[model samples]
Each structure stands twice: as C-alpha cells, then as structure tokens.
Target: MTQRRTPSGQGPARRPGRTSRPTQRVRVRDTSSTRVEPRVARQARPVAAKRTAAQKGATKRTVAPRPRAITGRATVVIAVLVALVLAYTYPLRVYLAQESQIAKMKQAQDIQRRLIAEKADEVALWSDEEYVVAQARERFYYVRPGETPLIVLNDPAGAARDAGHAPAAPAADRWYDTLWSSVQAADSEPRN
Candidate 1:
C-alpha cells in the first residue's frame, strides 16, 4: 500500500489510482482549560444504572395488592347484567308475538263485520215485494199475466227429437230454471 500525504498537512493521505476518502473532523473538548465541580460529578450516574432504577420503580407500582372483595364484586355485577338481559328477552318476545296476533285478529274481525253488513243489506232487499218479483221474473222466467216468454233456440232440430215430449231448453238455462222453480215451489208448500 502506498500513502500520498497532502502538502498542507491538515487533510488525510490519498492513494495513487483511487479517489480520496472523506475524513471526519471531530471536535475534541479542551479539558486542560475547563473547570469541573465535584457536586455535579457526584450527581451524574451511568445511563444503564438510571434505566434499571426506573424499571424497578415501575415493577413495584404495577404489582399492587388487590383485595378479593373487588374481584368478587366485579363478577357479581357481570352476572347480574347478564341475568337482567335474559329476563327481559323472554317477556319482550312474548309481548311482540301477542301484538302481532292482536293485529291479525283485528283484521279478521273487520272482514267478518263487512260480510255481516252485506248479508243484512241483501236480506233487506229480499224483503221488498218489488225486488222479489223482479228476481223471480229474471231468474226463473215466471212471466206475469199477458206477458209471452219467447224462448230463443240453438240447434232446435238436434234438441227437438232428443226429448220425447217438447224441445228441451238449453242445458244451462234449464239447470238454473229448475233450481229456481224448486226453491219457489218449496216456499209455496203449506206447513201442516
């Protein structure tokens, strides 16, 4: 290794072919001129000793003696809170269920009341002689005096020979007429 020193004598030496390395300029304390007090020297302790003292103090404070009464009280408080929540849950659920049932029953009662009102109105209408006569004429074809009832025919030839006597009426009209005739006939029957 070759050492090439600077002519000024302050900077470090540089190698022949390589770049010069940077040197750190440290400021040294002039201890020969400064005066030190004995009290300040006694007060200063090493950093490791200071840290150990702080850690010992923290450990002493953290490990406090807790009584059994405080721990038992905390456990009782938690249990009571849980019991209160559980006790309220059942009654709350039952109340909600009953409320829903009441709503449904109210709706059903409203429907029933509406039906009863409609039936009562129908009964009132039936009690009127005009309404009854109109119903009998339209439904059963019960013609009054001097009123000719004309029966319109569809496939009269097919229907003519089918019945041994007269031409049969359309099956639909006959069914309704027969039912109405039976009801009227029953109402006219004398009760012994």
Candidate 2:
C-alpha cells in the first residue's frame, strides 16, 4: 500500500499494482434557466392556478395513450380490406360463372358431336347395298326377284286407338293402298 496526497493536503491510501477505477461523471441539471411548461407545472400548482394553467396547457397535445387511435386505424384497415375483397370477388364470381357456362357449352358440343357421329354411321349404312335393301324391305315391304313377302299385323286395340287420326288398318293390308292413302293425306290442305 502507498499513500497518495490530494491537492487539498489530504492523504488517501492507494494499493500497489492495482490501478484506480475511473470515477463516473454525473451531469446535474440546471433547472434555474429551464422553462416550466404549463403542462408540467399543472400537476404541482395550487388549485387556484390549476384552472388557469389547465386552460393555457389544453391547446398543447400531450403524449396520447395508444388504444383509441390504434382502434381507429384498425377500423380503416378493416374497411379497406373488405372493399378490396369485394372488388376482387366481383371479378372472381363472374369468372366462375363464365367458366361454368363454357363447361356447359362444351358438354353440349360433345353431345352434338356424338349425334353427328351417329348420323355419319347411318349415312355409311345407307351407302351399303345390303343395308339399304334390308332397311327398305323392313320399313316399306319391298320384295326382290319375285320373293313372296309376308306382313305382320299390329294389335287391334292399338289400331282402334289411332283410328280417329287416320283410317286405322292392319299392317297385313296391301302396300299400294297404304301408299296411296299417305299420298292423299299429304296433298290435303292443312287442318286448323
């Protein structure tokens, strides 16, 4: 241990090989020159001064507590989000509707394509000589090379039900009579 003398003629002991720790400097505020704002002075002022000081300080905005302003901002954000969702949804709804319509049209087109394919098959069948002759003989009772043809009769009950529309006859009747009757019906004027 070594003894160190201060400038004021006082002695303090210093330890050997251990440097002294630096002293922390603290700044003291000089409130003498500072202005006491009306807001800060309001709390410490007398009741008589409180009214006057509060009136004066009311115009200066203090640090605001956050919730009200935060809630207001949240409301605006929610409204904007809702508006944006609606704006996007309108187009999305229309897009979905159009997509559904396109799907329906495509389905209808597929059905029509199938019908066209069936009609094409019929045309191919009609182009064949055997198929044409067979259809003609079945539908119109056509005979080939002096072949004897037989006619099958429809039920008498069905023939009676259709009697009012045209003269109902058995399918066993002569083909020439049925053909002549159909020609006469076609040449007649349209009924009211």
Candidate 3:
C-alpha cells in the first residue's frame, strides 16, 4: 500500500511499485440540529509569501506603544520637589557662610590668645630684677650704684678729643655765640 504524504513532506515515506488503495468512508447519523459545512481545500504557499504573512500578523499583534503623558500626580510631585529645593537653597548658603565666619572667628580668637600669652611671658620676664638690670645695662648703658662707669668710643677722633688733646674754645666766645655763628655761616651758604 502507498503511504499518504503531507505537503510539508513530514508524512511516512511511500514504497516503490505500490498501488494506491481507496480509503474507507464511515457514515455517521445526524444527532444534532446544527448543519455541517464542507471543508475547503488549502493551496501550498511559497516560503517568502509565508514569511511575509507571518510578519504582517506579528506587526498587527505587536504594535509599537506610544509614550505616556505626564499625569497630574506626577506633575505635582515634581513641582513639590522643585519648591523644596528652592526653599532650601538660601538657608543652605547662609548656613555655609555662617560656618565659614565662625571658623574665621575661631582662628582670630586663637591668634589673640597666642598674643596674650606672649605678652604675659614678656611681663613675667620684666618682673625679674636680673632681666630688668640686664636690659637697662644693654640698652641705656646704666650701671649699679657705686660701680665705676667706663664708656668706650667707636670713633678715633672722638677718642682723641676726649683725651683733652683738642684745642679749647676761647673764653670770650660763649657756647651760644659759637652756635649762632655756625648757624649764620650755614644760612650764608648758597643752596644747591
């Protein structure tokens, strides 16, 4: 017997030199009032046509979705967030500025404290009699009572004059007369 083959060639294979047999027909009794319709024959389609038909069906079923519009609730939430940010901006800036000012004030206070400590140390040093004597002796050439004072001159001319070898001023001309004469001489000179 020859085997029936499907259009897709997935049916059982046919044997060579076999004769085709007629299929048996079964008759069924009508049990319902519904009428039966005859089946329509299907034609084989090309692969490209089948693919295009499948693609058309897929496109019809799966349409591209449109972008959603913003809802009222979402808009209100975004507006609230923006308002919150705006409200916080000034306060945040002020807080940072005040913090920087506070830091600067603290630095100034630290510097003042250091200066006060230095002054206190200087006062403590001044309270010592030995340090005071040493400073006075070094700065003003002061000496203790009953101590002989000896002054050393740096200029050789001043040293020679102090030794009493220079000529003395005349008794007739007082010190003021000499000073006046020098001033008059300076006034008489021509200016550059």
TM-scores of the candidates are 0.44, 0.44, 0.44
Return the lDDT, model 3, position 190: 100
Off by over 4 Å in 3: 1-65, 69-71, 150-192
lDDT of 2: 0.77
The whole-model lDDT of each prediction reads 0.77, 0.77, 0.80
Model 1 misplaced regions, further than 4 Å: 1-74, 153-192
Ranking by lDDT: 3, 1, 2
lDDT of 1 by residue, 1-192 (tens): 534445443323443565644576977788798986665454554864776577643322223355576587799999999999999999999999999999999999999999999999999999999999999988998998999998767986677678655765656667788899999999999999
lDDT for model 3, please. 0.80
Clashing pairs in 2: none
What does candidate 3's lDDT look like per residue over 1-192, in tens digits? 544655454544544574555566988878598788898896655864876576532322233456569888999999999999999999999999999999999999999999999999999999999999999998999998999989875886677688978755546988899999999999999999
